[model samples]
Each structure stands twice: as structure tokens, then as C-alpha cells.
Target: MSQQQTTLHVELGDRRYPIYVGASLLSASNLIAGAIKGRQVVVVTNETIAPLYLDTVLRQLPDTMLVTSVILPDGEQYKTWQTLGDLFDQVLAARHNRSTTFIALGGGVVGDITGFAAACYQRGVDFIQIPTTLLAQVDSSVGGKTAVNHPLGKNMIGAFYQPTAVVIDTSTLATLGEREYAAGLAEVVKYGLIYDPEFHRWICANRDLLAARDVDTLRHAIQRSCEIKAEVVAADERESGLRAILNLGHTFGHAIETHMGYGSWLHGEAVAAGMVMAVRLSAMRGSVDVDLVVELEQLLVDLGLPVWAPQDMTSATFIDLMALDKKVIDGQMRFVLLNALGSAVVVDDVTEAELTALIDG
Candidate 1:
């Protein structure tokens, strides 16, 4: 491990794992090798990422360890059963066993599918997350909520499998396009809105630094976001209770992703708009002040995130798509709403009329 690396533990009793956050972590071969559980390894990545970092990762593995690579076509549209089957094909063709470790070497799409593949392949296997994008580094890569998108809904098919470790290299953010980088700021803003108001304020204060990709600012943001998610996942690994708070904007966001088609609006972009919708709903229900909604919207806007659902999407369409969301319980849609700034709760009491009004108006 590098001296500058920040390590946070996701405490899940025996399933606990360390999240390493810092710069140049991709070069830490010992750190990468230490997390693997067996002699055989398969590094799962996408075509877009393989050309950039696959060789670097392969070189990190011990010479004695058998390492193979599976590179899938890049995009959210590719995150499906067919793509997952491709991963399985590679593993089966290589004759890998349960002891084989799967290393995810791209962003959230790569991490989610790879982790889900690890969860189902031969019942289960160990996996490592080397999240290269800001969105994955701050949120998706740390949580272990792995899955692929279904045409009807997002993450409807998935598991609660945990990773052996998460290695985040801030240097990777340098390669990200302007839009992708902005999308990540949405998830970073989520931790602040739902759990730490102070963190939210800090992000508001550091917008320029964050946009500029300042290393110190990103390291702190990634570490804090991981810390918040680690604590939540430790308490509720399966989204039974407290963990649902982490999905503050996801319910509506997933609906957008499903309705618009995956890869259309980035996950974080959809979530940013979804969060604005949630905040608007909260204000309509008298759960929070309208000023709070305005404040949150402005923050997201300042960070280059969309605060409105797409103009083409109807309220009824949102309702239809959201009904298929994973948060639905006993046929009732459960929404994560803010009780106040820095606090959130899941409620099933929201009426269809209320949601329709919120979406339409």
C-alpha cells in the first residue's frame, strides 16, 4: 500500500473488507495480490477500459497466479443477462473453480456485472473491485449491491454479495470525459444530502476544486463517501432498513434509467434529477421546507447535474417504470424521502396521485 492511501473498513463481521482510496494505487501489486483468495484469477473489464489499464492490472498479479481477462463491450446497454453470460462463458472456458477470484477493472457497469458474476458462478466466489471512474469509486464499487439492468427496471435482478477489497486510484479520473465526471459528483452530493449535511456544505464550497479534479479534494470526497456507505452497509447489508437511505435518489433514478433506456442518461445524472424529484415530493408532503428543495436543486445544478426529469417523459410513464423498482414492497412503492436535510427515511405511504402531481407539475 502507498503511504498516502486512505483505508476504510466495511465492518460486516467476518465478511469485512478494506477500501483503499488514494493516488497511484493501481501500481500497488502487493495490495492487489493480497486481496485475492486463490491461485486462479479472472480480470473482468470492458473494451473501453482494457486498452488503458488491463495490462497494468495483469502485471500486478504474482507470476505464480494464473490470471485471465474478459473484456466486454462498453456501455450501460451491455449490462444484461447476455453480457453476464459472456463472463460466465470465459470463466467456464478457462475451467475456473469456486476459489477463483474475479477482479472488476472498470467503472460501475463492470463492477456490478463482475460482482454479480462472482456471486452466481459456482454458487459464489471471491471478487475484488478496482473502480476506475469517479461514480464507481465514490459509490457503486464500495457497496456490493451488484446487478444488471432489466428492460423493465434497473437492478431488478441482482445480489448482496460483498467484495474482498476495493482499490480506488484517483489518477484514473483524469481520463474521464466532462459529462462522466460531472455525473459522479451527483453521488458524492447524495452522501451529504442524506447523511452528512456538513459534507454537502463542503461540496458546495469546493465546487471549483472538484470540477478541476483536485487530488486532495477527490481523496477526501471518496473517503468520506466510502465511510458513510461502509457504515450503512455494515448495519444493513441487504437494504432491509437503514441501508435504504443510501438509495435516496435511486428509486426515481432507476425509473428514469429504465424508461429512457440504459446508457442514455448516466446513472448519476438520473439520480441527480431523481433527487430533485424526491426533494420536491418531500416539500409537497410538508416533510421539508420549499427552500430546502431550492437549495438542493441549486447545489446539483452548480455541480452540472440535471434537476428535472426529461421533458419527454410523462408522469404516468415514471409511475409505471417506478412500480417495477426494487424498492417496491408488497406491491407498494417505497420511496426514500428526506425528513430534514441530512436525514432520510423510506416510506410507502406516498399516494399515486401525489406522485403523479409531483411528476407532472
Candidate 2:
């Protein structure tokens, strides 16, 4: 049975777009085809996903449309300028023009790189996100925060380009690897923590259902997560202030991804540990109770996520790498810390001593 589809919109004034969340949406030809502004479409995917759902998506487009598939190797390690340049090579070789619509057919890596390509291709073009992974569906694919990673930082080189639409097929989670699916849950937990305490509590109580990949449970989780993100993005499309709160654990998480090497620690795993750190720091500053740290750590553990930073990475290592984070402004470190569950604040007054104590302790 197909799950009921819920449609939400990211109201970006002139650029508002709809997000469709449900089961078997990849087969929704109308949803996919309607979003393309032109007859030219570029389906960008990776090896792993291409074998799984690429052909299925291709079958949706009408035979008359100019369709090209740019299949790249899969992995977070591959999100680089070198790979991006190569992607451009493929599109240009196909003679794709400004009318081309780039379709991202995999997880966050594919979505980020493909969106960046669309953003730069002919100065700008349309793109649709068919996020297969739970992580991409819940977080990365929704907000239009597109980018390729840099050696110095994660998402350092990117744009605030929105997708024409998002088609999330919940059934794809059935094919997702255990770790990847769990990593996605970290983002789900984040929504509850930073924006909705009741949602967080629901996630905790329903961990078993989520772990088992219950369709209805997963659908609710994805829809609610996207709704929160959409609300945040609509208010601050450029991350000027409010939207930055959406990056609850990203600063520390990005450092972990950079230091441990991209793909070594999945973005969501790093964020799990990073959230613990952020909450711990909040406790240190008396913004939130120290028990909130323990509560979050236990929840992550229950959700099969890492609750603490890697043992090999010292506090100094985190400090050094985090200094390079995109959130840093004018040499001041800003952290999104929770004053209470469901209430988050961005603070730049964190002293070095506080960081050392949080990480080293």
C-alpha cells in the first residue's frame, strides 16, 4: 500500500518550492516531470545508488526529453572540486544548456555536488532532489544549502540554491545500510532537541519502531523534520541569524568529519557526538541542566549513534579544526547551544577555557 503523500512548501518569496514526502514517490512521474522547467534533464547519481534506483527514475521521464545520466563514484570522500569539475565535463560533453534541470538521485553527497553544479552551470539552472537516504531526506535535501566539501572545512564552498522540488521516497530506506540509516536518525533527534521537545520525547519513546524502519513511524519523522527545516529556511534563507540555529551540532560535527577524514565519520555520527558536546558546554555555562547532556547521550546511544567524540581527537585538535568552521566570524567562535530542550540559542561568548573543559573533560 502506498503511504499518503504530504506536501509542504519552502516559502522563499519568488523561489518557493514544494516538498513531497511519501512512499514510492520516485515512481510519481507527474511530481518529477512537473518540476523540470525544460526538456533537458541531467540525472546525477553515484555508482551505489545508480544500480538501485537510477533506472527506475529514468523510466519516469518521457522518451522525448533529452535525458543524461552522470554516474559518479559514491562516498563522502568524493565530494570535492576535482570530482565536481569532472561532473561539469560530462554535462558539457552532452551539450547540456541553461535549460537543463539537474536531478540528484542519491544521498547528501550527490545532492550537494549536483546542486552546486546546477548553481554554477550557466550561472544557474533548476535541480530536483530525490533523496534516497534518510539523512538526505530529513535534512540536506530540503533547505537548498548546496555545496562541495573542502579540505579546510565542510560545506565551505557552496551556495544557498533551492531545488525546484523534493521527492522523498520512504521505501528507499528499506535498501539503506544500517549505519547510514542510523546516521539519518541523528538529524531527526536534532529537530526534537532544538525546535520541539515533544518531538524529541516521541523519538525517544519510539526508538525501537524507528530502528525497525516502521514505515508510518519513519514517514512521520521525515515529514516533521522537513517541516522544521522548512520553517527555519524560509525565515533565514542565507543563515544570517535564525537559520544558523538549525546547525545545532554542525560546527563540532564538521571538525570531526575534517579531522577524521571525510567518510570516516558520517556527518550524522559526528553531529551526534557534537550535540553531546554542545549540550555539555551549555550545561557548563548554566544555560541548560547537565542532565540534558546525559539524556541526549543516552538517546543517541539508543538510536545507534555515537555519543562522545573520538578518543584519538584531543580538545586542542577540535579547537584547531573548529576554528576553521564556517560559523566562525571575525575570529569569534559561535555555538548553537540549547537553553532548554526545544529552545536553541547562538552564543559567541564561549571562552577557550569552556571549550577545553567540555572536550578535554
Candidate 3:
């Protein structure tokens, strides 16, 4: 963008891509054009975001580019095999080829589904991440972690497909409702908690500015989160080792999502609550301090994020679903627990007895 932007590059071998974060990124067509390897475009969005941001994004594409649009139903409940399969059906019917570029034009669900479709289509095709929500900008869009939920587990079926480029328009946050904005902030808070204590403290200090979508504060938050995520994804793109640490609160969070049913709670809301549970669990194990748990909870509370699982879910159900989580390997459940703020460890050594107490409490 001629507006003079600070560009971030994700170096992933031959699949390297650039992430541009600034104002009017979608309206800036050359930046978008620079990312795509070929001309054909398949813009996948949903009913909710279509009327709002789709056209503005499409306006950026050149008249020579053939753009096909697909707007699916809105909500996480629809992030399924059936939902994702529709993109394949639509694209394949149109005879989309290896050169076809899929553009994810909504929030996480759209990004995950579109990226997964990109991974599988023609044995793999190029896709762009145009993450509209704050959560997507900070977490989903940058990383290549793509997936569709299974009735049995969250992200049970998916692929790791990097985007050709990620275009994040900070302006979109204005339309996000308070609850939805808060949900996205949960991920932002996560980046701070898991990796950068300095960023965590910055978030704490700038809570008001962030809540108000102050550009300078928001830009810093988004950029730092992407930097942390890009480094992790580079080291362990498939999440075999170091990358799993990114799932700090996800193990418990995914369980709540499964038992409650998807979309009932926004993913970030569930993660915020889940992180609180993990901290509490860690403290009860006699390792983590109680004060840290409370402080973390307070930060989330300040952001208007949920700090507890839904009252409707039975602990027994929560446990059962967690057992089936993708993190479970070698007949043991692996959890990413904090050693302290801004650092985490994936421990598989916690006993069944200890786990039961954590969930029961």
C-alpha cells in the first residue's frame, strides 16, 4: 500500500508469505494482486460478513481477474465437513484448477475452511487470508492451521495450508459488536500470556485503548501477536512439539466447545474461560501460584471475556470429550500448562487422578 505500511514476512521455506497489517488493505488491490500466484479467484465468505466487507474486498481485485464468490451460513456450528465440502463442490463444478486461488473473507471459520479447501483442492492450491475479525487477524490468519470440526472433536479433520498472503484491515473492527470484539481479544490476550510477558503487561496497561480499538495500540497488539505466531509456526508448522505450546488453554477450551456444541460460545470466549481453568488447575496441583491465576482471570474479566465453563455442561461430559481431543497421543492426554506467565510447557505426565480433580473442582 502506498499509504506506507510496515510489512511482516513469514518465512516458511518455499511457501514464504507476507502479512500486511494497516488501514484499507483490502481496498488496496495491488497488495492483494501481488500475493496471488495466478488470476482465478474463489472468494469464500458467509452470510454474516458478505453484506458488510465482501464487496469492499472484491473491489480490490482487477477486472481481468475472474472472481467467484461463495457465502455460506454464519456461525461455528457450520464449520463442518459438510460446510467445507460445499466449497469443493462449487469450485470443482466450475472446473477450478491448481491455479485457482481461494480467498478466505470472514473470520476463523471461513479462514480454516477456505485454507483446508485450498490444501485439498487439486492436491493443493493457493489461498489468501483476508481475516476480518480481530481474532482472525491475531491468530487464525497468520498460522496455516486449518481444520473442520468433527462431531467427536474440534479441529479433528484438517490440514496445514499456508496462505499466499494475509491482508488484515484494522478498520473492520469498528463493525464488530462488543461481545464479538471481546471474543477476539481473548486470542490477543492469549498471545501475551503464552509468549510475551511484556506484551501481556502492555495489554493490561492499554486495556481501555484496546477495548476502544485505538489504532496505534491495536496495530501493535496485532503485529506482536503475529510475530509470536509466525515464529512458532516456523519452528513447528505441524505442531509436533514447540507449536503445541500455542494450545496453552486449548485442551480444556476445546472440551467446553465440544460439550456445549460449537457456536454456542464464541471460540475466544471458550478459550478465555479455558485458560482460567488451566491456571486454576495448575495452581491446585501445587505448582502454579494462585495470584497468577487470579491476575489472568482479572485481565480476561477486564476484556469482558468469560472465565468459566458453561454451567450447563456436566464435568463428566467435559472430561469425556477432552479425552478425545487431538492432543491425546499414546493413550495419554497432553496439556500445555504455564510454567509461569509468558512461558508454557506441554506436560503429558499429569496423572488421571490429578486430572479428575482439576475438572471436578
Candidate 4:
């Protein structure tokens, strides 16, 4: 961690953690090692990410630990029970006890699987989220939501297990493709739309900086998103009410992921398309102006995000898929809809006809 690096704290009673963000954080093994200060570490990553940053993270870890690694094939489709089992097998095979730490050293997919693995292994263990993807850095890696996908739905079986520390090295974002980077921006944008209007305006004003990956611009965006998410998580750890707000575009996004087949469209891509659909849905509710949809869609489009679903999925089919979102309670589909550009409302009474019209329109 450099002197210039900014730290965002997630104060949760005694289970508090810190999010470290900056350019060269990955190299600050001494600082990271000091925080966890443990003896047994298992860095869980994927084929794609392993060849890149895993070794660098392991090298930085304190000498007190015996670092082992389990590499899985990278992608959303791999975030499953069987893949999670790989970590369990490694932990068991390595004779690691409950004290063994798990490090998620990849994107959201790796972080989710690693976190869920940490939650299940020996009933639970400490894990560090070293998220490499833009999406993971801004959203998944910060929140305590960890899961493996069921054939039925995305993140259907998971736990709300917080990490010991969230080590976000923005330099890792350099490896991301154009589409992947844009996908992450969708999530970063979501935080502003849901809670901070000023951040939203900052995003709109400096869209070019974000698109070009300006260091200062990216850092602030990630920091704000994490701070907002951390606060919401601490208040409603189980997502009873407040935490559900974090799933603003997730309901529709999950549907896009499921219907399109996981891995075909990136999570951020699905969320981008999903957010556009949400704006249209909000417009139909008359809570938000039609221009909001136009603006949101255009921004995402200009960012190279997908603003529509695949042709194979019809409007009605998409609605049916959305009904299966994790946020649904008592068979009511709760939606986080924008009431204004910067504020949002949770409404479950949205009509299916309205959904079809918004999507089909």
C-alpha cells in the first residue's frame, strides 16, 4: 500500500475490514501480510488469472504462511458446487485446519467461488478478496455476497460471508478487455444511480476519464462504490431490506445471465443490459422520466455495453426469468427502480405487461 493509496473501512461491530485501493497495491505484500498476519493461506484463482497476478500476490504474502494454490478454469459457468469442491479438496488434501485462509485472486467469479469455498471449508475460514476484475473490484469483492450458481439461477446457493480484507489492486484492471472494462463500469455507475447523485454526475461529467481508465477517476469510483456497499452491508448483512437495494439491476441482470447462458455474456454485460431494462421499467411505472431511460441507455451504449437482450429471449420469457431473482420474497418480484436520476424505489407491484412493453419497446 502506498502513501497515496486510499483506505475505505467497513466497520461491522468486531467483524470490520478494510478495502485498500490504489495503483500498486498488489506489490504491498508487507502491508497486506501485516493485516491478515496468518500462517496458512490457499490462494484460489483461475486459469486465466493464474498466469498473471497470482504469483505476485503469493510472493507479497507474509512468510508466516505456507501459501498453496488451487486454479480453476475462469468463467461464470465455473462458479458451481463442483468447482467449489476443488478448494475443499485442496484444503483437505493439504491438511489445512479451520485457521487456513483463502485468497480470491481473480475476478468476481473467482471471488464468489473462493468466498463460498471459505464459508464452507471446515464450516468457515478467513478469506481475503484480491479481486482482479473491474467488476469484482467495484462490486463483488467488496460486498459479503458469495455464491455458486445453481442450474436454476445465478448465485442461488451462497453465503453472506465477509472477508478479512479486500485488497483491490487497480493495476490488475489493465488486463481486462474493452468489453469487460465497460461491464464493470455498469456496476460502478449503479452505485451512483442508487445512492449518490453527485457520484453519478461525476461519472457523467468524466465519462471519458472512466472510459480511458484514468487512475484518479477509477480510484474514486471504486472507493465510493465500496463505501456505499460496505455501509449497506453492515446495516443489513442478510439483505433483509437495505442490502436488497444493492441488487438494483441484479434481478434483470441475473435473468440475462441465465437466459443467455452464463459465460456467453459477462456479468457486467448482463447488468448493463439489465440496468437499461430497469430504466425502461421505471419509466413505465411513471416514477422516472422517459429521458432517464434514454440517457442511461445511451451512456451504456457509448461505453460499448449491451443495452438489449439476445434475440432468442423474448420480452415475456425474460420477465419469467426475472421472477426467479434472489430478491423475490413471498412470490413477489421486488425491483429497485429509479424514482429520479439519483434516487430509487423498491417496488414489487410492477405489472408483467409493463415489463414486456418496456423490454419489447
Candidate 5:
């Protein structure tokens, strides 16, 4: 690893894997080469990202290896069983086998679909995560929660298959659009809200630097976020208990994504709004002060994120969509709500009246 690079690992015992975060690490063929489990490699990415970083990644693999690149259309709408089937078709046509190591080289949409493909293809194959977006770098690419969306609910079908390694090159953020970059920050801010109060205050204090995309600020943010997630995943790999806290705003956010149609709102954008609603509900339960909700809303607004759900979405809409959420168990609905700033809990006792008030009020 270079002096500029930071490496952390997800401790899944024999299945443990490393996450590399740094500047220009994509050019480091050694890191990429070291993670491959076999001589055959398959790279899965989207059209938008393929043009940007695919070649650089391809260059890292030796010519002696069988490297096939499958590029799909970009967008959340493309994350479906059909796209996944198309990817399998291309890989099979190229004669890839169980020995192939798949690499995911894009943002969340690309990463999730690719990871899920790796999990199911040939009964599971080793895959590396080359997450190019901030959201993927800090969140999705780390945990083993791989899946594609369904019309009724988000990430409804998937597996707990982990990656062999994760490579996050900070330089890719330079090419990201403003909206996408801000969307990623929503996840970064979520780390502070759920696990670290000091980090939360630091984020609020350094909003300008974060907005400016200062190199050091971003590195620290990505590294710390990964560390928190790593610790959590190490403790609860399958989200059986402790890990559910990671979805602090995701329950409400997923409902929004499904109701609005996939791709209508970025995942992080919906989560930003959802976090506020969760915090508002926490205040209603008297677990956290109402003032904290205002502070979080202000911070999200300052970071150029939405702090409210869509104008047309109603309590009825949210209830209907969220009822289909994957987190629901045995006819009971579970939600991750803040018990306090930097503390989150999963509760199943939230009454329908409370939810209606939280949404309609």
C-alpha cells in the first residue's frame, strides 16, 4: 500500500476481505492482481462508467488471463432480473467458468447487480468491488448485502455473499456529477448520525470542505465511514441484529424509491429525507430532543440534499410500499429509528397512528 492509501478488512474469519481506499490506486495493478482468485476474470460495469474507468482496470489484468468485460446501461431502472440474465448470457458466451473472478466497476447500481451476479453465477465465484462512486465506496461496496430491486420493494431479491476485496479510488469522484456527489454525502453523514457524535459534529463543521471535495477531508470521511461499517459487519455479518442499525434512514428511503419508481430519486437523496423523518419520529417517542431533528435537517439542506419526501407521496403511500420492505418479518414491521444522536435502534412497536402523524403532520 502507498503512503496515501489506507487499507481495512472485513473480518469474516476465513472469508475476510480487504478494502483499499486511496488516491489513484486504480492504477495499482498489484492490489487488483493480488485479489483475484483465478486466472479467468469478468468485469461488470455500466455504460457510463465503462467509458471512464474500465480500460484502466482492464489494463491492470495480465494479457495471459481471460478477461471479459460486460457493460450494461446505466441507471437504477436497469437493475433487474433481465439485466442480470443478460450479464450471465454474455459471460457464458465468453466461456467463463467457476474459476472466474468477477470485478464490479461502477457505483451502487453497477456494484449491487455485479455482486449479485457473482454470488449466483456458477453457485458463487470470487468477486472484487472497484466502487467508483462515493456511495459505493463508503457503504454498498463494503457489506455483503448484494441485490437488485423489485417493482414492489427495493433490493427485494439478493444474497449475503461477500466480496473478495474492495478497491475505492478517490480520484473517480472528480468526474461525478454534483447531484450524485451530494447523494453520496448523505451516506457519509449517516455514519455520524448512527455511530459517532464527534464525527457528526465534524461533518457539520466541515460542510464547506466536503462541498469543495478537499482530498484530505474526503479521505478521512471515507476511511472513518468504512471503519465504522467494518466493525459492525465484523460483529454482525448478516444484519441479524446489530447490523440493522446501518439502515437508519433506509426503511423510509426504500419506500420512497419504490413509490416514486426506481431512478426517480437517488438512493442517498431519499435516505436524506428519510433520516429526517426517522429522527422526527424518534423525537415523538421522546428518545431524542426535537431540536436534534431541526439540526439534522439544516445539515442535510446545507449539503444540498432533500430533507422532505415528495409532495404527492402520502402516509398511505408510504405504508403501502414499506409494508413490502424486506425487513418486515412474520407480518410485523420493523424500523430503524434514532434513540439519540449517534445511537440507533430497531423497533417493531411503532403504531400506525404514530406513522400517520409522522408522515402527514
Candidate 6:
């Protein structure tokens, strides 16, 4: 039998595009070629991903279009200005012009840096996201917030540029390492925790199936996640207001990434630990019940995600690092905390004393 397919649209008016979700989408030449705006195409992917799926993607492009490939070293640590510069060198060496369309063909790191490259290249160019990992398919690939990480904070330098299309081939997940696959679940759980209480319950009930990578379950999770994220982006493309809630565990998570050094912990693993901290802080602030904290932590643990912050880091260190977060405004650190199981809010009123106590405990 043939596999199913799903499509969602990001309503950005003139900048709107479609997100195609299905199995074997990499084989769909028409879907990929139709999204390209020009005859010149550059595919930017990481070393780990290149050997696995690059040729398949290349096969999908129209023969008439000129194509070039840049294979970057795979890792969160490589999401830097230097690596981005390397990508630019390849584009320039190939003589790719402003009309070139760049294709990001890896996970979140590749998607972010590639999209950022497209945004800055010749003032701006078109790009498509062909995200392989579940994390990228559901979260990073849908949102146009692209950036390279800084030593001080994650995603400190970037742009709010949307993509021409997001092609998600679920079959690619089969190539993901177990740890990476589990890491992606952190973002999946985030959607449930922040906006869909029922989805949270669904995740809890289907934990085993999801961990096993059941196709139907994986498809539903990815589809729903894209739907929720697309809706949020449509309402606030630049994260001016409502979109901030999407940063649920990111403040703490970004701190962990910076302090631990990027790549030490997978983005989703750091986010899993960070979500626990956010929930605990919410409880301390009297916004949520302690039981809710335990529940969320249990869920993360069951999913093979870490629920504790790194033991080596002190509370003060976390506070200092978090001050560098992109969400900080006017010297106040903004946090996205849950007030209930499914509702999240962004607030900058978290006092140092409260944060210190929570981190210390």
C-alpha cells in the first residue's frame, strides 16, 4: 500500500508557502522543483546527512537547473559565523547569484544556517527546508527564525526569513540515531505542554509507540505539530507577541547549550531538561502545582530525555548565561512558564531570588 501524505500552509500573505509531510517525499521531484524560484540551486547539508540522502535529493531536481552541493561538518557546534562563511564561500565559488535557491537538507542546524545564508546572501535569496529529523520537521523547519548560535547564547544572531517550502520526508527518520530521535521528542512534547493539553495526554499514552517510531503515530505527531506551529507563525511571523510562548523551555535550554558547549547535549535533550526547570519555577512562583511538575518530568524521563540541569553548573552561572538570551528585554529576563497543563505565558517578572532558589534546589 502507498503511504499517506499531508500538507499545511503558513499564511504569510505574499511570503506564504506549503509544508509537505509524508513518507518518500524526497523522491517527489515535482514537489521540490516546483518550489524553486530559479534555475540555479545550491543544496547545503551536513556530512552525516550528505552520504545518506544527498543523491536522492539531487535526483529530484530538474535536469535543466544547475546544481551545487556544500557538505558541512555535522554538529550543533558548527552552527557558527565561521561555518556560515564557509557556505558563502561555496556559493560564491560556484558563482551562484541572488536568484539562486538554496536547499537545506539536514536537521535543525543545517536548516538554520542554510536559511540564514539565504537570507543574507546578496541581501536575500530564496531557500527551501528539507528537514530530516523529527525536531526539524515539527519545529525549526516550519518557523522561518533562522540563525547561527553565538558563544554567549543560542540563536543570538539570525533573521526572520520564511522559506519557499518545507519538504519533510518521514522515511528519513529511519536513518536517525536513537539518541537523536529521542531528542526530537522534546519539541514534540513542547507543543503538547504549551498549547494542547489533549496532545500532551496523547503523547503520554503513546510514549511507547512514539519511542518505537511507529509510522502512523509519527505522522500524526509531525502533522499536528506543524499545524500548531504554522498557526502560531501566521499570527506572529516575527515573534513580536504570541509567538514568544513557543520558547517554552528555550531560555533555560539555550543557557545549557551555551554553558555545556553546543553539541555536548542535543538541542532536544537540553530542552527536555530546561522544560523541567521551567515547570519547577512555575510551581515555585505559585503559577502551577508541584504535581504538574512531577508529571511533566516523568513524561520526559520516560521518553529518554534528561530532566535535570547539569550538576556542574551553579545557579548564578545559569542566571548570567540566561541574561544573554534573545528574549531578554531591557535587562529583564523573559521566561515562558506554564500556568496550567496546556497553557503557557511569557513573563519577565521572575525575580533573581526566586530563580536562584529554583536553580539551587
Candidate with more favorable, higher lDDT: 4 or 6? 6
Candidate 1 vs candidate 2, TM-score winner: 2
- Residue lDDT tens for model 2, 1-361: 3559999999999899999998888875478988887999999999999989998999889899999999999999899999999999999999999999999999999999999999999999999999999999999999889998887788889898999999999989999998999999999999999999999999989999999999999999999999999999999999999999988998899888898999899999999998888888888888888888888888889889998888888878988998888899989989999998899999999887888788777
Q: Where does candidate 3 clash, by residue pair?
A: none
lDDT of 6: 0.91
State every prediction's TM-score relative to the real structure.
0.97, 0.98, 0.96, 0.96, 0.98, 0.98
The digit string of per-residue lDDT tens for model 1 on 266-333 reads 99999999999998898898988999889888888877889988887877887788777778887899
**lDDT on C-alpha atoms for all candidate structures:** 0.90, 0.92, 0.86, 0.84, 0.92, 0.91
**Pick by lDDT: 1 or 4, better one:** 1
Stretches of model 2 off by over 4 angstroms after superposition? none
3 versus 5: better lDDT goes to: 5
Error of 5 at 191 (Å): 0.8
Model 5 stretches astray by more than 4 angstroms: 1-3
Ranking by lDDT: 5, 2, 6, 1, 3, 4
Stronger candidate by lDDT (1 vs 6)? 6
Question: Residues 1-361, candidate 6, lDDT per residue (tens digit)?
Answer: 1268888999999999999999889985478888987999999998999999999989888889889999999898899999999889889999999999999999999999999999999999999999999899989999899999877678889999999999999999998998899999999999998999999999999999999999999999999999999999999999999899899889999888888888999999989999999999989888889998898888888889999989987789888888878889989999999998889999889888887798876
Query: After best superposition, candidate 3 residue 179: deviation in angstroms?
Result: 1.7
Regions of model 3 farther than 4 Å from truth: 1-4, 312-315
